[model samples]
Target: MESAVLTQALMRPAAYPHPVSKVTLIETHISQVFLAGAFAYKVRKPVRLAYVNFASLATRHADCEAELRLNRRMAAALYLEVVPIIAGPGPLDVRIGGNGAALEYAVKMRRFRQRDLFSTMAEADQLTGAQIDTLGRQIAAFHESAPVTGHASGHGTPARIAEVMEAALNGVAELASSTEMTGRVAALLRTRAGSLQPAFHKRLASGHIRECHGDLHLGNVALIGQKPTPFDCLEFDEALRWIDTISDTAFLFMDLLHSGRQELAYGLLNAYLECTGDYAGLVVLPFYTAMRAVVRARVLLERAHQRSAAGAITTAEMATTQMRCNDLLDVACFALTRRPGAITIMHGLSGSGKSTVAQRLALAGAMVCVRSDVERQRPPHGHTAGGGDLYAAAQTARVYRRLRAVCCLGSGAGFPMIADATFLARGHRQQFASLAARRVVSFSIVDCNADLATLRERIAARTGQGRDPSDASLQVLALQQRAQEPLGSDEWRHVVRVGEPAAVE
Candidate 1:
């Protein structure tokens, strides 16, 4: 359709009640988009394909309406109702004539500033860690509220995964042959496909499938008044929309890594896991992320092909694309096979830098630190006791029990658990060692010791900063010193004198 015709169609009362003096056509390969006033309208091109079909005006209208309905689930306030435009005798007529003949349908939406998108924010380093945590919680809640279908939806099944893989391989092969994605990339794609087929089937049987946002990426997310909101869901195909939940999340994770936000990527993944409690899904993430990356690579290659004659798909550009594909495939391989494990326990008196060290180690992905100070402060029987009532043996036993349980669980899940506690006695260390032995995992304990003056200074500084959780007064520290026992020869223990960096190292 001509730009004028499309503009006129958008101006119809059925499309937009308000007057629009000017309209801008945003041309995309798959759809004809128009920006009218404060609203954006999208109309699919008249084409029939294997994955999507909009061959007729009626089908396009129905799809438009479908898109409006589905996207409203996430962006309800943004996706306005769809409107039908009728064509008459005039070439660009939008009003109804003798018979109201439908000309086209437009998917209307609230216009958002392009610069407010997550992709732009990430490029500017404005997508903070806190924002990513919020995004994780929001997406977790969305997935929980999303509708779940039966087996007939063709989701979470071996056949469905096979179909998706076959389609992706076919698309990649066609793009590679027509474009310049040859040599290492072509070989890597084949190798990844072969390695992933078996795991795909296993995941299908494990009921890891759900209806998901098929095309989740940075561009599809926008920050509206500082909150990340996802929009423009893929409504053209049910098969594409219904997929493994991990596969859905992997798209954004891969996109983040591709955009050079590995820290945020890891944080997002960790936040999502903490929220959804889906640790089992981690095993399938690599394969899903790899597939998502290759899908994008293939789409980029196809775009390159369309501009081949314009020198856009040059030999050098093709090589860059190949390198990206290889990198993604390598990440997938490493994610699937490499199982990282390490345990670093922090033992010290109150205000000895255990929490600070634990925080740094956790952020570095070195260990999952469990802080006893934090755990002990938790309710039921925390630090409310006076001198006579404080340090109850039963309370100490309960804290140790909780610590051992968390350590065992983390170790069993393939992540070394770092237990941060005041190991004042040999019994305390022995309890953790027993638990590690039961799980067939190794444990390392680092004893942190500081002078009385240094400990007092650190404790005062922590209190000034409002970060310390301990109630260790000078009297409590003196009591702790008297109660503490020296460590004997133990292979797992290492003594580190705090505030003396050279000696510790």
Candidate 2:
């Protein structure tokens, strides 16, 4: 194996024995990727960075194998095998079984078109809520089956988390819009880090820390055969890969928000919670998201520095990069702000704009929403509302009971929460108020009132839409109007109106 042979093979596609009509070479800071026909080959550079070391042939071989093994767990069909680039006596060739000593190792993968990439789809506005839902479910399932890294693993401790945060802050401090802002954020992060020490310890004790896809973002995910598939996980460092499961998810959540897909971010988080029943994870989300933001800013700064040093960056390009870094820092600061906790219950019939208001509130970072329509159609409440016993007296009571119980559980976790439901019965409304009182959280009712004609029209239009979660019809609205109870004088102070200019009663 000679250096000249390996270099020539990398530069010229004619070096390989296979038919190569066209070739493309992609180079990153630490790797070189060659795309030929139907396969992509990745070779790690022989360099040592602060976080990873691939300076020796042995180290490169190990890291290449690690990349292949870890990525195959999620992208099974995409990751093929690690093949050797042998320097034969005549010419360099990629051989399966030969006696020639290998010059380097490359991870061979089944390549798909760039259009299938999630990043590409996002640029084309092709990223959909359904795709985000599939991604959430897939990641949740993967985390559930991942190996747990508990306190014994010593990777997800509070101190370790603080180290990562500090590193990220230092990494991007020079590139930030203001050094004072960076210092303030660093101080705030330290303060919060101390506060979350107990939470980190608790999650570790509960086995919430596990081996994860450390670099989860839009660019790392792709749609293969119309299904969301995550790939290209962090493989060089164990400290990066072994993390709290929620922190792993926060990466994608932050990426979606940064990409201006706020609704999809909320949907993804809600769907993940539905799959894992890990609503408690919400407690650490602010910190996790902030950390993710800092990490992203650091990466952007690194790229900007590299381009500037290479004289490839224009003044406008550098300004845009700086703006992006500033934006991410702002997101971090916003995520760190403590939001008020309250129980906001929506009281209205179907199509009264309750869901719309609740969704808007959730997107505004006010609270996480729990909708009755979506819940009732799932699990034990999987009943066809009409002829079946679903709307029967006892069954209706059970549904409300379940909804109230879910609200209680969510509020107990210390998050601001919105319970979206048609609280037509005084008993049901009072039940939530009492629960909120017991939890020591403020309770408010939003009266999503509209004209009778408007409500009827909306109901009919929604029913015809066919994909709405609610099964309510004009008949349901008539029954509700006759049976609905007005808020008592005692509850007036806590009531708000959604459809009016003035929100409060």
Candidate 3:
């Protein structure tokens, strides 16, 4: 880290547009920032690090130029340009034109108010739901339009991430001795690494990696004209910048949850999934989130050791970072334990609109809709009381078994279940109710009621259109009415009149 050259470089008049009455130097682990009036300039230290390399003066200048170029993709108004400083050595005492040869380059940027950063906004409680949603849309659009890279180049694959994690841990180990907590953390990382291998291999084969914002989190986001915008993407390493889109977005999601905004985290995730139709990517979220948290923890730990005299964060802040890291690790472990199994039963007679309602609910969450009508309509599975009919028996058994299986799976995975079915017969209703009761899980039976004429007309229209699963005619509807059993006063059965809002009781 040679500061004499940089100090002289900063003294040149070409570095500043206005008179430099004073120059404030800010140093971080990787770079030195110079704050001048109305502008800030960053100069990468000529230091080679394991995760990032800025070893040579030429490489540092090239990286500074690359940073300006890449960041302009998202923040054109902020990244002014990279300017070369012409200087002559004299203990760094020089002015804009006061005698100097070409020395070095610096990334000049428009200085934004500290309050514009999301971290500051969050501290002030100014980060709102609308802003989160806006960020979701922005990131979604960014991912949609970002360049796609070849399988070998994309940095999002599991193997690549594992390598990064290993490198990061190596760096941490180099900085500190092995302790009980570090040992546990290392073990957990190994387990997560193992779990992601298969999935990572699949992505590698499928070429799911693309160019992404390598570093995305609250601090990198800012409000310009009251609009949340993402900026400061990592431009130093092409390997770090190209990654799985989910891996890119996971950092923000983890940060949100860590900030005590779990609901917003969930909302942002759902929104992104909906926009991108990357539901399958959900499986990899917890792993990426934990990795991001650990990375932040490592950075904060380093910061605790090197904080400036007056601006250093308190001891409590360091402890909080440790706690947050532990919490994130726990979340990652919990997610690994979850196995997807979900079932929704659509229960309602012909013309009751139970299928319609079930379809709507299914769109909001991850659940498989099992329709009795569809099951019954399968070839020989049609309504017939004949014990010899194997297809009929199998389909009936499958309908019941599928419902039960889904309920068990959803309960175990901690997901909400919506069982849609027509509970006309007491025995049929009891079967599901009993299963739910045994699991101590919530159940809602939507017993739909409508005017007889209206029901008959709806059934006729459905039959004429050939779109409805139920083949029941008017006569069958009459039979259904005669056989219908009233639901007893219970917490689970929710009897609602057709076209009316649902009542929980």
Candidate 4:
């Protein structure tokens, strides 16, 4: 049977055994999704693309099974099963999910509301930081538990990653005459990808590579049961799915930034780092971010070309898609452009609003903030080497050292960073100053201050809320006050003050 005939049958509401008044058939370049009342059935197109080949019945079935198995890893409740599309004896009598020799295979999923999708929320200006925050934590947990690759898979190696990036770049570039993803954008992406091979290999060696949700854009996520549930992972390509966790994160981050939600991007990145403590990813994130943008641009460009060739898209629609693709390319170029780096270290008591200032800088995309309290709590995943003495003098010194290393790495990569901690001692402050000098980046000490009563009240409220990672107590604040050393004249020269209306800038 022809593929279009089967899809036409599935589009009929009567073809479904379940009670449905209408069937909405949404078509993509690779798949046809029939949204029945309570369920949706997806059938892959039997076409060979540069990246994916679903030309044969067997291959389509295998890809369907792969999609079902992999999507169930994170979204168990949404993906129900893979069902066979059977044809009855009568002519033009195709039935959905029945017992017979199958003509096609379909992935059956429980239908979810369109309004709950992250893309929908973002389009309506309803997406929130809290939602992105929750999304970050959930994705972190998922990545930590996802299976690691063996030596033979050859999935996460720099060669394989570059292969995929180059393919995506070329695919988008082929459609460049009709698309706005021009030759210049492709050249920039190629140059940046080539330069970041060492960083990619480093992440792979450090076990940052694993099976990830390769397609982690907003449209693939939904707020199911008040949780940001990710579904529809990339199943056609192993190299795309098996990658550095930061690469997976960079997709959604790029999507948010492209959608003009910078604060949500910062919240998402910060929240994920808080959970996983993978601050080192900050250096190579721009490269990964550009790659993701190219990937997205490929999707848009390819889809527009395919539809135009099929006579399924109007000229106006194709022009609109081209503009969107150009916008994504612009974002790709901007992400790769490096700005002058700087360091901002917080100096204040526990409740003196130091963390607040750090958060503001991060939200503005001015810097990546690393908090001491969060780092002190995580001790090598399972070793627990320093878990028993979080506040011991040696432990504190170790935390400062680690913070300086991360700051230097980020600054060296042309990204500003902030170390969120009470720099009460002169020695701790000097280490960061030395790092800034070595990196040739400007350094500022943000001295956050508030009245004593306000400080105590804020700490009390934070303790009651219990959502903050900080475990600072009243006693800790007392100790911070007594241990605080007055900044010398030299130290005062590099000071930036906060906690005042006009001082933040």
Using TM-score as the measure, the top candidate is: 4
| Tens digit per residue, CA lDDT, model 4, 246-352 | 99999999999999998898789888888888878887888888888888988888888888888989989988887888888888888888774798899988888
Which of 1 and 4 is ahead in TM-score?
4
119-163, model 2: which lDDT tens digit per residue? Answer: 888888889878988899999999999999756667999878977
CA lDDT, every model vs. true structure: 0.68, 0.79, 0.66, 0.85
Best by lDDT: 4
For candidate 1, write residues 257-303 as lDDT tens digits: 78778768866765665455454565556667767876776666555
TM-score of candidate 4 on Cα atoms, chains taken together = 0.94
Q: Write down the worst ten-residue block by lDDT for model 3.
A: 496-505
Tell me the deviation in Å of residue 428 in model 4. 2.2
Question: Over all chains combined, what TM-score does candidate 1 have?
Answer: 0.70
lDDT of 4 at 447: 89
**On residues 43-122, what C-alpha lDDT tens digit does candidate 3 reach at each position?**
77766656677777788888988999888888888899887655444555433323445355678888788789987887
lDDT of 4 at 361: 79
Q: For every model shown, what is its TM-score relative to the native structure?
A: 0.70, 0.78, 0.66, 0.94
Better of 2 and 4 by TM-score: 4
Candidate 2: C-alpha RMSD to true structure equals 5.8
How close to the true structure is residue 8 of candidate 4, measured as C-alpha lDDT? 76
